[model samples]
Target: MNIIRNPKDVLSGLLFIALALLFGWQTADLPMGTAVRMGPGYFPLVLSGLLGLLGIIVVFNGLRTPGEMPTGIAWRALIIITFSVVFFGFAVRPLGFLPALGVAVFVSTLGSRLFRLQTALIITAVMVVFAWAVFIKGLGLPLPLLGPWLGGY
Candidate 1:
């Protein structure tokens, strides 16, 4: 039996395979120790292998079936999310963790159909506090609590 032959699926599969190979190649240089004590490269190597396998499966499935394919890319949401991430990266250094996170959340929430201003605010607050508490305070990741106001945390 023929599997789905959709342009979107084929493109996605190819992209996944390329990314997996890139990741695998990047991780290959890292040291891989014995099974008892895994090295830094171990997890990435395994993950890349799995990704490659999934990509192959997707490609094969696509080749075997032919059908109408819905447009895979949601450009609006994708653009919004991408910009939000970019904004987060830029704002995190200058605006501090809390404000950067709030803006990120707000920008990201704009992608959703059900987003409300109040809910976005609440979610941003919750996410910022949670991230601060968990990553900065609890895990002790040295993230900047304050921005340029205090000259870099």
Candidate 2:
């Protein structure tokens, strides 16, 4: 029996619900103080509850409306994106934050068939600078812009 009229909404709702549950479970041990003097768990629990409520609404909406059939996931795109993230995790220390970020963004762009080298380069440069500012300048995280090999040490 076809239970879902909109597969995308149903799947998205389920994901949100799962995340909410996980978040709630993780915060269960933390003390939940009052709204005025909120504890560490307060915000996460409230957000998770709201997310769960939204998920229920979306699931009901999906069940009530007709939608397109579920399409196959783009495996190539998924793999490329995942690899890019993993690569960045490993590359950050050796390659430095800027280079690692550049490679990650560039590799992720390749996940799309419309990837253009020039566009990727431009995007990489912009994102690198943005990340540098946010992580290094704004937040003052001590991420090396250039690694030891590049004299960033």
Q: Of the candidates shown, which would achieve the greatest TM-score relative to the real structure?
A: 2
lDDT of 2: 0.90
Candidate maximizing lDDT: 2
Candidate 1 clashes between residue pairs 3 or more apart in a chain or in different chains: 2-64, 2-65, 3-64, 3-65, 4-65, 5-65
Compose the digit string of candidate 2's lDDT tens values, residues 37-103: 8788998999999999999998898898988766888899999999999999998898899988898
Candidate 1, residue 11: Cα displacement in angstroms equals: 8.6
In order of appearance, the predictions have TM-scores of 0.57, 0.66
Weakest ten-residue segment in model 2 by summed lDDT: 138-147
Give each model's clash number.
6, 0
**How big is the positional error of residue 87 in model 2, measured in Å on the Cα after superposition?**
0.7
